[model samples]
Target chain A: AQTVTQSQPEMSVQEAETVTLSCTYDTSESDYYLFWYKQPPSRQMILVIRQEAYKQQNATENRFSVNFQKAAKSFSLKISDSQLGDAAMYFCAYRKQYGNKLVFGAGTILRVKS
Target chain B: EAGVAQSPRYKIIEKRQSVAFWCNPISGHATLYWYQQILGQGPKLLIQFQNNGVVDDSQLPKDRFSAERLKGVDSTLKIQPAKLEDSAVYLCASSLDSGRLTDTQYFGPGTRLTVL
Candidate 1:
């Protein structure tokens, strides 16, 4: 079984500042994928970024980037130039390359302060 | 492209009652997923389907919950004798075939269920 863990329950960051949300996972599969999703109060789940285990280089989406350390089973999301729109519940997810089930972490509530 | 679609944005029912939710995946998506998201918690996979054929349902509570993707496009989930713990947001998501390692999933707005 694969499990994702987000140690932080909540995080706050000043607008335009940078913030990093930590995530860890336990998976026996050598090939898998990691993802970060954002859900605002509206309740829509939006994909923020994704990282492939085989790729040594991390994934980035404009202001969003990731620091993935496969050996340590660590994958953290970094949000640069955070804005008010970034305020939402963030989730860390894991999925095996050949599997369809996606395991998710408890989630972290991000609050962007102006 | 239109994202996943789920009906009944919110539902309120008493315990022991039956309820159902519907979902329509993206036009060409070959994989669909159903998840339960409890307040203050992350979403948990309830079931997954690949072109109307179930791929996984290990975590689903079969005793009271059932789901089907009859046509390989749209899906429905039903719960009978609902319990208080069944109160949660039900989300639907779709993605391209899992064979593509880079396939990303798109999610619906979700149906919020409250069992009284």
Candidate 2:
């Protein structure tokens, strides 16, 4: 079984500042995928970013990026210039390269302060 | 494009009662997923389907829980003789194609179930 861990239970960041959420996983598969999802008060699970284990280059979106270290089994999410809208519950997920199911971490609640 | 759609955004039932939630995936999406999310916890996959065919359902409690995706589009999840611990948010998600490495899932608003 694969397990994902998010050590931080809650995190706070001032608006316009940067915040990083930590995540780690245990998997024996060589090829896999890592993801970060955000769930706001609306209860919608939104995809923030994703990284493929085979690719060493990190994945970056408009304001979100991921630091994926396959060897260390760590995948962290970085939010730049955070906004009030960024406040939500962030989750780290893992999926085998050829697998269908996704395993998720407990989750980290992020609060953006004005 | 329209996102995944889930009906009855909220439901309240008593223990040992039965409840069902409905989900309609995006048009042309071949893969659909159902997840259970408790308060303060991340969403957990309960079942997965590909074009009305079961792809994975190992985590589902078959004795009390059941789900089906008929005609490769809409899906339904039912909990029979529900337990108090079954209170949670049920989410539905869909992907264009599970075989594609870049396929990202789009989620619905989720149905919040409260069992007393």
The sequence of per-residue lDDT tens digits that candidate 1 reaches over residues B34-114 is 999998889999999999898899989999999999979999999998999999999999999877878888999999999
- Predicted model with the maximum DockQ: 1
- A95 in model 2: Cα distance from truth in Å? 0.7
Q: Give the residue spans of candidate 2 off by over 4 A.
A: none
Query: Each candidate's TM vs. the true structure?
Result: 0.98, 0.98
Candidate 2 per-residue C-alpha lDDT over A1-114 given as tens digits, one digit per residue, 9 for 90 to 100: 899999999999999999999999999999999999999989898989989999999999999999888889999999999999999999999998886678999999999999
- Find the 10 residues in a row with the least total lDDT in model 1 chain B: B96-105
For candidate 2, what is the TM-score?
A: 0.98
Model 2 per-residue lDDT at B17: 97
TM-score of chain A of each: 0.98, 0.98
Clashing pairs in 1: none
Query: For candidate 1, what is the lDDT?
Result: 0.94
Alpha-carbon shift of residue A107 in model 2 (angstroms): 0.7
In candidate 1, position B81 carries an lDDT of 86
